[model samples]
Each structure stands twice: as structure tokens, then as C-alpha cells.
Target: MHPHSPPWRKSPLRVWLSSGISSLFELLNAANELFSRPRNLSSPRTPR
Candidate 1:
């Protein structure tokens, strides 16, 4: 592999790493929404 190769075509490992990182970020965003929103809706005391 040439050092000057284009970034996307670097190697299978690099491609997989980039994709994994993106998916991890997406998962984190989803987790943040889930935790942040429910605090108001699902409180410790039940609404009657």
C-alpha cells in the first residue's frame, strides 16, 4: 500500500475502523436521547 493513497481506499482495517466509529457515535446519540427524555415522562412518582 502506498503512503500517498486516497484516504477511503487505505485498507480494510481502516475502512472497518471508520465505519465502526461512525456506528458507535450513532449508538451514543441514541442512548443520550433515551436517557435525557424519559426523566420527565417516567418520573419516580406515578401520575394519577
Candidate 2:
């Protein structure tokens, strides 16, 4: 085989990377939402 690779061979890796990145972004978004909205109990950011 030659040193170079074909497009079909790279598709699986590219797809996997894309999916992993999307999942990471989703997790970050969930964390951001939770931080943005505190629990029902008292919080330092919210005054009495």
C-alpha cells in the first residue's frame, strides 16, 4: 500500500471525532445551564 490514505478509510474516524465533540459540547451546555439557574435553596449570589 501507498503512504497516502483514502477518503473512505478516514470517514469513520472523522465521524467519531465529530460525534465526540458534539457530546462534549452538550455536557458543557448542561453544566452552564445548571450554574445559570441555582437550586431552590439559598445561594450566595442571591440576596435575601
TM-score per model over all chains:
0.63, 0.54
lDDT of 2 by residue, 1-48 (tens): 678787867788888988999999999999988876676444765786
What is the C-alpha local distance difference test score of each model? 0.86, 0.82
Worst 10 residues of 1 by lDDT: 39-48
Error of 2 at 27 (Å): 0.7
Where does candidate 2 have its weakest 10-residue lDDT segment?
36-45
Residue-wise lDDT of candidate 1 within 8-45, one digit each (tens)? 67788898999999999999999999998788677855
lDDT of 1 at 19: 97
- Native RMSD of candidate 2 (Å): 4.9
